[model samples]
Target: MLSKIQNTFILIVDDTPKNIQLLGTVLKNVGYKIIVASNGIQALGILEKIKPDLILLDVMMPDLDGYETCKRIKESEKLKNIPVIFLTAKTQPEDIVKGFDLGAVDYIVKPFNSSELLARVKTHLELKFNQELLQTLLNFQRDMVLMTDGEKVIAANYSFLKFANCKNVEDFNLKYDHIMDLLEFEVKVEKNDVSKLLRLPKEEEFKVKMKRDNGEYLIFRIKQNVIPEKEVSILSLVDITQLENQKSSLEEKASIDELTKVYNRTKFQQLFKNILEENQVNPKSLCLVIFDIDHFKKINDTYGHNKGDDVLVNIASFIKSQIRMSDILCRWGGEEFTLLLVGSNIEDGVKICEKIRVQVQNHPFIQDRQVTVSMGITHYLPNDNLETFVARADNALYLAKRTGRNRTERN
Candidate 1:
């Protein structure tokens, strides 16, 4: 939430230079952006150029009076929404009524107290902010908003009525008193104690997930604002479903290798670590196999990097087809890959690796070239951590390469 005074712009339109200086100094010292205009005509010209959040207009001016200037402003389509406050020397009730009738939201006497000026400015600014915020939410068509006075619903936006399938607030109340009761909220609340939940201390914000009429799921961030003086609570449900979906899509893309479309080393490490922790309690049979293309560098040097990449992609797809859905495959590094065989013992792991090695030997990766792989197989040990376990498999791979290329070794 941004502070009310931050980024607030006020236009001071007065004939007196001393009054303008005093008001500008007071507002600027409190962190407000101020634009000064000497008379009402100049102020209206400035309004045509820059729209300020609030305006302070003097009732007496040379060419155009404050009342006429304010009238012209209220007639304009773009500038009518700006809140205008009149600075007048008159103290009669008719003068105040005339200012209000001419569209001035408030009036301040010429010799005004600084504290009262500050308070009125702050109040009107916040009121404008709230009104604009609600209008914006309605315009975007993504937020469902409603106001309640603890027990009864006072008002609701069109989006809320549409969601509830009602014509108006009265129609909505006939079916549901609390907005929380209209949907299946993910957060659990007491059955008959909704007021306690609505009156959350300090107006806490939370999230809820619900399915829409079109069978799609939507997530909303609920924000509650309580007005202690009015005893009203404004509840806003901001739609964040698209943002959450995009975040998950980004995370999925991050975990996958770009070339082979298989899980990358980082994702593989996370999955294996979780499995190792779970195995300590359940003790399931698990196997880890590390394999790499034999003479991969020579193949890349002789053919091309493009052909090498194609071979890697084809090999990954074939291996994925041969493995079970429960198994995990990841691209460990350049020309190297890992396979985690869940619920498979050492013997079954070695047999699977041998089959893959023989199949690669027979399969022609290119028109006239043969590609092969050597694998090292190892199963989980009760006392092994991730580092020690991977190191053992890597040592076995070194042994297999040392003895002969295209063979599987168990360690």
Candidate 2:
């Protein structure tokens, strides 16, 4: 159809003005934009400015001949793919063979029929368009694609070759059973029924963990479809290992404090609520301890904010080393910390708090100065909610601060 050539451009190069005009008129009448050049030199000059889809080159010309011009075109990396067809009066078999050897797609004798000229032009242009489209799709695709005849690989894209650790498809031994053996996880399809499995619903996808030849483990979501006409199966693999890792990283960051590297207040509260609910059902002794640095604001005022941060960091590290793995320690706020001790009553909580107080007083902080902490301990009550329970502990903390600092008080 003429519609295919509507937006296409063609170049006509000839020494004879009559021949150039005639060829231009034929191509122009069929909806192609035409550019004329008198000789090979002029054609090469015009090529610098405009890239035509097809070139109708004359065999004989003055100065630079058609053969040399076509040779130069083929040599150029940018212009090499444009189809060149020879239009000349020479009908010798040797001359036609020479034209083809010089990179001409087709040769038309001087007294050529209009129908023949148009058909050759249309066919070559359609072939060029399809080749370019296929290359573009292959270069831009992200998923790894492979074409297999159930027993061996027929073809594969660049992604598949890279995953297989092969420089090219020919270098890889891609046998069906051999590849299945390399995978760490099993595929749902049976060994003898790969083609039958591919004929299942197109929406079905399989998740697999594969151990690559390069000693790396990769997770892929794979889909397969059958090409009934070719008697082959097309397989697509989408890598999802990075996506899964990102999800886990996000969940950990959400529950952890950035500065202190401990559980944050939000996550601590949620965990505490869960523990409280479990304790009510099982009736186990549990205790909550709330503590804060004594004269923390005075330290910040005396020696800049940086030193204050150092003190806080050192205190948190020290406390983490002293606590059991089962205990939960959280940074409740700027200078305050809260602890949840499972299977511990008020007496047990007091012993732990006193130990922590003595350690804090003896440990050297920034500038070799001693830091002290005041603590308040309270046991869980049978009829206590989150608000009422925390309120009692907070009241005990206030009493400790009012009476004297650097000591533990129980409520």
Candidate 3:
């Protein structure tokens, strides 16, 4: 979210110290770095040296009046776009109109409100910030903005290597066509639509996927615009893989038991939603395993609570190590842990739970010297809902507890 901002500087021009001091204090507080000029001539000298982002010019002044200073500023080609606002004692509508006719963006009559002054400054600052941001995005890394000619990439920004997943920019210098046919894009890609974009030369974003050199599919938001003075289309592609991964990671964190770092009850419900959404197309076999450490409360009583926490961490780590990356593991409160295996059926899911239980029972705690686990496992039914899936797993977990501790049960 960090961005570049041009015109971060503000110049305050006034003959009176009182007015300058008041405006200078307010603008600086709101994060606009300030430059002060005591008179109109002093302001012109500073303007010649450094073109400020915005200038607050006072109408009444000795030597050159505000009108002459503003007229001189307008006459210069380089300083024309740099906005000028009038600060004046004259509240007459005609005076305000004259200030505009001389090329002022807005005017403040006499005393300015802290909120109103800040509001105007903040708005312009943000506008400049966005423009600078667009500039940065265009030429970031090898992710260059390119203007293409028909089927081939004609030219690109500094960020050229990323789109094609190439190692170096030299590979992109050559013309490339049949890119859409080669990349295996899920959605239709139209190079012709880029011509329609020429009418309005603003960035337009559309969702697209890129096939990496390693055959990995990466999500991207592609932005296209027409380049001024050049008969070409500008293309900017931003990778969104990190955003998607972060969203999944946060969702997992939200449902986890903090102390044990395992999925809590909240994660169980969310996992169901994820499975069902994907189940509409893919033949995903959903599996859940619930495990609780044996005699955990008594262990807390024998050792200090710290030791009991250590025992839980050990068990969770043991279970976590045996699982595949496609599985979800979370602390389901207290000494309990839950695993959601993405594609494992009942038999495979049961085997996974048994392996974890035996691993916990056989491995002595490096600290406590003794600890064990009992587990219950279940597979998702074709018609199973959230409560039903979990209830079946819980039943098996209870059955494991009934048939002596430190064992696994599945149905």
Candidate 4:
């Protein structure tokens, strides 16, 4: 039993009315809607008015021949993707090749077999429909698309437009010069270089700063790849700024001194291990200094625990401001504080310790009256664990307190 086909729009562009009638009859019988154009020029005029799913063009015409007409249609951004099949009398190799060069997907000879023509058109129509569907899916999918040749954006989806805070696709009409430009982006791409598209390898991901017009910056991950047998490239963009922010918050809260707003012993222990491991691999001199407020109990007794807490907060702030960026400052419970100076050797660490001790003595932090601290500074031995490292610094701190307060001792 023969089945009826659904209506498909097909444009028949041929100068001869008889050929159009024959082609029209075959397609119309199969439930296709036919639009006729007597010549290539007429076909183009009709094209501007109506969009066809497929076109059948006779190569021979008085003017505006099939090749020229097909070229113009293929160049159009909207019409270029539509499939064009040539109707040709010339079966010569060069003629066939020329039709293909002009973007004809297939050719139908003059005095075409009805079944053969229908079968080929049916195949091409199915394929064109699938391609169009795929393109639609890519344009509207939740993930953002960043298409490029290597240097500039060819196209991007709605999600990319929303995230980029761009007025429209025109904003990114030519942004990005290289894959790395999109890498770990700290800012939006203002300029695009198209030549970089020729250089990107497959499956490489880089972090980039993506900036929007509204001064919002997001850290995005970019995945670059070339589509097989295709002229354009496809890039997938994902916003990762939230993940990085979460990581920062978690790190900050993980080992924070709750009362003093300083680094706690937990952070010190973790950082010390990592620093030591790094030093072993890259080799850097470091020193640890431990200290405690002198007569802390007496201060608590006289000024109440609230004043004692205030003293710790004030002292912690003071210690933090004095240290270099490479140094780690932490409150080590009770009245004790520890310093992990990354680049400082034993002598330099002691000099820093002495400075802190003298600063404490001269400053005389007064919640009610003067307060002072005895400090101990020591360098970590090779492969020393946290317990042993603390013991050595604690011993030095004990010595400083033994020989009066407000003094620094290093061992």
Candidate 2 per-residue C-alpha lDDT over 228-289 given as tens digits, one digit per residue, 9 for 90 to 100? 78787777889999986798899889988777888899999888888766654332467888
Of 3 and 4, the candidate ahead on TM-score is 4
Candidate 3 per-residue lDDT, tens place, 162-225, comes to: 5565533335544244334323334554656535543245536666676666888777666667
Predicted candidate 4 versus true structure: per-residue lDDT over 260-352, tens digit per residue: 888898998888888776664222367778889989999889889998898899999988888888889999889989988888888888888
RMSD of each: 14.0, 11.8, 18.0, 5.9
The C-alpha TM-scores of every prediction are: 0.55, 0.50, 0.48, 0.76
Per-model CA lDDT versus the true structure: 0.85, 0.82, 0.74, 0.80
Q: Which residue runs does candidate 4 get wrong by more than 4 Å?
A: 1-5, 92-95, 136-141, 144-240, 280-284, 296-310, 363-371
RMSD (CA, Å), candidate 1 to true, equals 14.0
Off by over 4 Å in 3: 1-145, 150-172, 175-203, 207-221, 226-232, 236-268, 280-286, 341-348, 366-369
Off by over 4 Å in 2: 1-141, 145-161, 164-235, 241-253, 273-286, 343-347, 381-385
Q: Whose TM-score is greatest here?
A: 4
Clashes of each: 0, 0, 10, 18
lDDT, residue 316, candidate 1 = 93
Worst 10 residues of 1 by lDDT: 276-285
Query: Roughly what TM-score does model 3 have, to 2 decimal places?
Result: 0.48
Error of 2 at 337 (Å): 1.0
The residue pairs found clashing in candidate 2 are none
